[model samples]
Target: MTHVMACIDYSQSSLAVCDYAAWAAQKLGAPLTLLHVLDEEKYPAAADLSGNIGLGSREHLLEELATLDAQRARLALEQGQHTLEKARERTVVSGAAFPELKQRHGHLVESLSELEAEIRLLVIGRVGENSNRGAQSLGSQIEAVVRTIHRPILITASSYRRPEKVMVAFDGSPTAYKTVQMFAASQLCEGLPIHLVMVGADLEDNREALEKARSMLISSGFEVHAEIRQGDVEAALHVYQSEHGIDLLVMGAYGHSRIRQFLVGSTTTTMLRTATMPVLLLR
Candidate 1:
């Protein structure tokens, strides 16, 4: 069976991610896998900085570098294993049954790419352990990972609770319509109240698309609310979410230039970083 995988690092946000993933697994009745990727490129002790090693000292320096590299590799392996163990334990305690743990080496995205087919849903923290800045700045790999993976990714904010009210940011793009179709068919949002909203100047086109989506969702037994909001896309969305007590935000991962200007491209990055609630991005 496909699994719900949670990508965790040795960060403050990792536990939060695990908790969300566990809750998702329990809700979706899917097996859980806790993944921790060890990126060796992030650690570089082999580089020669001195630049002034005599022939006599060159052999010794090379030997020293090799030894250091070996030690670092060993330490990294140990740390990865420990992190996975803790993640598994935490997820299990959070109500996931027999969650699997895996540790992979190399770029995080590459590792995820290899495991993509097996992942039904991906849950990851907004930033990893390496992020020194606070929640305002996303992890270096966040954008790349989200753009590369076609699977629905749940970007965990500082905390998570199973959402009762979810808002979908629809822009009338093929991607947005497909997201509505998927949401209507999937058990992920089965009984939750959904708001299909579009932010634009014209209410006419927005109303048509929202009506179409609302009808489809209603046909599938979902309680759907359709609306058109005006103003800056991100600002309006966050305001609506806060005012309505929206616990989750769903939207397309990418869209055309016009919608991208408002929702998907760089604006998507900003929203993910600043959103107080979790975001589920569909491709």
Candidate 2:
């Protein structure tokens, strides 16, 4: 919880992650750490040889397999190091303070959890290394990371855009209120105008909740545009974004099992998959 951490991989978007992490570090006045994990299952250091072996030649085959696996693991480590170096250089060029480079050999979610206490905010790519160029397909670890890490996560697009106009997708829940408060206090979007949007029936309760959140932001010295849109949640938000040219989308993310299931439904995953702009999710 001392610095901002950005997850980097072999994807081209990893550069954008570095830039975003640098920008966030500048704003929050925290150190920046670039994390690259070499998943053991994906890049094993040694081949499994627990199966029954018959003859002396089986030992030779096992040794060959183990050597090949070790070479693969070494290659993965080298690639990760190169990626981290590039990210660090980019961060320096972006005019932020130098960043700490961290490389691990394990699952991404597990690594993130291990470093959770030292991260104030987590920045990651919308799509993992396996996804295509477009941010249309989500990375495999997106849901798992969302479910495990109880911190602010900024999921970026294929590219980076310095956020100018910020929007918060409010659902009128306690999580939503916490998001507003955290956004206001963090100074992450200190000078940007905020659009507080809720997509649903504009009932009395919704209106009051929206108004309250609006006032809170206003009191924090932000220009607030609060409104309720009708239609599908993702569709409505996209329309509003297109109409106003929102640079970044913000939303509350809860890590509880039930809450995470709901977020996977149409909120976090939908926006991450569809929204072209960077999305900042807070828990």
Candidate 3:
């Protein structure tokens, strides 16, 4: 069965992600999997702590380093296990029935890619344990994971409530149209009020697409509205979200071409960072 996979790290936002994942799982009638990945590259076994040590103590230093590495591995295992247990308990308390817990060791994106087939949706925080920047900047793994995994990802904020109103940033891209259809068909956003907003001066061309999408949602029993504005995408969407009281933002993730891989789309990244509420990215 497909499951909603929530990535849990040592970051402060992990609990929020878990709770939101539970809510999503309940809504979709899918199980929730709390996944914790220990990326070995992020944690080194040993650092060069010996500053100008004499040669006589070099053997002892090497032995000590080996022991320290073993100890670090042990601690990491214990911590990951404890974290998973807590997350499972939290998910159960949050109304998820029989949520699964998993801990893996490797690159997070690679691990997630392998599990993509079984994952219906991915829940992750905007920032992670390695993030040194404030909330304005995203975690390093976010881009890679979003690009690598084909599943829809719910980029969670520090907190989440069941969204009453959802806004779709429509740009007439194929991916965007697919996102609209997915939202209409999927149980994730069913019964929510949806707003389809496009930012551009070319309303003549956008009207047909907007109307089609709006019609689709309406047919699916969604309370749908469409609007068009002119300005920068992120700024326009932010204003609309604030003014209209948007509880969730949904959009297609940027494509993963070589150029895009090297230079991530600024609009998506910036909007994801600046969004006050949760953002659902469909790839």
Off by over 4 Å in 1: 43-57, 261-265
Instruction: List TM-score per model, in order.
Output: 0.90, 0.92, 0.90
lDDT of 3 by residue, 78-100 (tens): 89989989988998998998778
Give the winner by lDDT: 2 or 3: 2
Q: Could you give candidate 2's per-residue lDDT for residues 2-72 as a string of tens digits? A: 88999999887888898899999999889999999998998987866747476665876787888998999
What lDDT does candidate 3 reach at residue 224? 86
lDDT of 1 by residue, 99-188 (tens): 888888678999999999999999999888888878746777888887688899999887667788999988787878898888787788
- The C-alpha lDDT values of all candidates are 0.84, 0.86, 0.84
**Against the true structure, candidate 1 has what lDDT?**
0.84
Clashes (backbone N, CA, C under 3 Å), per candidate, total: 0, 3, 0
- Give the C-alpha lDDT of model 3: 0.84
Q: Using lDDT, give the best candidate's number.
A: 2
- TM-score for predicted model 2 compared with the true structure: 0.92
Q: Which residue pairs show collisions in model 1?
A: none
Residue 222 deviation, candidate 1, in Å? 1.4
| Residue 65, candidate 3: alpha-carbon lDDT | 82
Output the lDDT of residue 141, model 1: 81
